[model samples]
Target: MMTLYGRRGWGSVLIEAQLAYYDLPFRFEEVDDLFTSASARKALARINPLAQVPTLLLDDGRVLTESAAITLHLADLTGRDDLVPGADAPERAAFLRWLVFLVTNLYPTFTYADEPTRFVADATAAKAFRARVDDYAQSLWRMVEHAAAAPWFLGERRSALDLYIGVMTRWRPRRPWFLAEAPKLHAIAQAIDAEPAFAGTLARNFAE
Candidate 1:
């Protein structure tokens, strides 16, 4: 069985949701304290050099880190092109484009917003950086809103992108903001929130 080291409501939720979608048997190790606990950090470091959660210990013993990578791997393992467009599919390019945008452009902003002190030496500077990054992330989200596929990011069919965006939107500049600024993406997030296939997984991670 595969072991997934991650916390509730974090990026790892996407991977866990995927696993649930495929009804794959795996063990979940709650290492949500990786950033705050010494022992947890050390343990996570043994599996992920970056000391990040959402680290998957494969049955073969290889450790996989990074949320997007893990989600893609799960899709590949299940051969679920329905969830992740196959390599030859025309939608694959668009899928990658949006996935990369969220992982690269939006994910980093959340990192900085969550721990601004890591990037700046002074407290005031850190405060400013956090605010700036939040604004930037919001702007990027609006841009994506224009490109979204109404009830989903990849058009009529739902993909892993929907799951990811649903969880991510719950973070800073949350769903309420999206409801106001990015109506389309907001609808997409809500749709994912109500998706029956992922209902149990999502409720387990996000009780509210």
Candidate 2:
């Protein structure tokens, strides 16, 4: 069994959704109230020196950091390589491209919205940073809306890209401008949220 160190947000929800989708048995350790806890900080540092949640400790003691990496690793373990596109398939390149795009381009947008100060300590500079992030996020999401294949990132079968996109899309309500500009992404998020696995994960971690 694997041990998952997670908190109550998207990082945790994403891992939970992947695990549930694969029916993989794992122990969940919640690191709640993360913003003010030394213990949480220390535990995360010990497991993933970067002090990040959604770290996966495999039974053999290997630690995996980054949510997408952990999810892809698990998919490989469960022989669900198709979920990420088979290694030899041409679509594999496309899969990798979008996966990296999600992590590097789309993911950071939410971070900027959540904590603008991290990018710039000065209020003036922070506002500028937020504006750039907002514009960049919108541009990327428009591309996503236009490039999306049918109902999923890769045609009909949902891939890890879909999962990542789904979580990021759910963050749009906070940015209002996102959905207003990227209606296709909004529709995609709605469809992904309605999936049983995604719904179950949300119910377990975010139910009101």
Candidate 3:
């Protein structure tokens, strides 16, 4: 079985959902807050220098970092296109485009804004930077909102993009903002939440 190193309710939920959706056998290794705990950072650094969550270790001991790379890797491992569109599938291009757009354009907002002091020394500067990042994240979400289709981000097909929408909607600017500003994406998130396959995973990571 694979081992996933992550903290609850972090970006690792995306990976957790997918692993569950595919019925893959994996164990979750909880890491303490990367931003606060020295030992957590030091321990994770040995496995992933970035000390980022969603760091997956295959049974063979090879480590995988970056959610996007791991997303593709999981698809390759399962050889099932359920969550990832196959190359010949028409949704392939759009899927690849938006997947990269999500990781490159939107996800970084949280990376920077979550712990702004890591990037900016001054408290005032960190606040301003976080505000800018939040504004930028909203704009990026608007772009996704426009491109979003009903039922799923890709429309009629449930892909990892839906998983991303579900988890990310819970982040900065959050579900309330998405409910009002990006109804389509919000609806997709709700749909994913209702998916029985991921019920346990989502509930565990996003417990109320």
Candidate 4:
């Protein structure tokens, strides 16, 4: 069995959807806000010093941190080329590009946008920063929308990228903005959102 430590509606949603789609047995441990919950703080420290969610505890007792790392690891562990293209595959470059685009650009911005005070002491500065970050994130999502290759980001086969981007579309700038500004990416997310395999998993994390 695999154990996942995460906060509801976070990046862990993608991992949960993946595990569900692949029929993997897993358990989830909800971590309270790392800054405020003493129990969440201590529990996360034991496995991940950063106190981040989406930490995967393997059956062998090894732990995996970082959402992208965990997603790639699962693909490799299952030897699913469709899920994770091989290095030699021509699409691999595109895959790496978009995946890195996601984690590097959007993830950090999302973090700071959500908790602007972490970066600056002045409340005014934090608010300004978050506003800027919000605009930047919307622009970045537009880039993703332009990159869409139809039916899915990478063409035919669904990869972890689709799962990830789909869930994230519901965050921050949100589905409403996507509907207006990123019609292409919005369609892809709608497709993934409609996947029956992920319905329960998504509801567990995102249903209001």
* Winner by lDDT: 3
Q: What C-alpha lDDT does candidate 4 achieve relative to the native structure? A: 0.84
The estimated TM-scores of all candidates read: 0.95, 0.87, 0.98, 0.94
Off by over 4 Å in 1: none
The TM-score obtained by model 1 is 0.95
- Clashing residue pairs in all predictions, respectively, total 0, 0, 0, 0
Candidate ranking (TM-score, best to worst): 3, 1, 4, 2
Clashing pairs in 1: none
Pairs of residues at least 3 apart in sequence or in different chains that clash in candidate 4: none
RMSD of 3: 0.8
Query: Model 1, clash count?
Result: 0
Best by TM-score: 3
| Candidate 4 lowest-lDDT run of ten | 34-43
lDDT, candidates in the order shown: 0.85, 0.75, 0.93, 0.84
Which of candidates 2 and 4 is the stronger one according to TM-score? 4
TM-score winner between candidates 1 and 4 = 1
Higher-scoring candidate on lDDT, 1 or 2: 1
Error of 3 at 193 (Å): 0.7
Per-residue alpha-carbon lDDT of candidate 2 for residues 1-208, written as tens digits (9 for 90 to 100): 8888887655667887888888888899888555567787786787788676778888899988787687678878888775677788667888888888877788768766556886689999888888888777778888877777867777776787877767776564443554687666666677777888678786676565
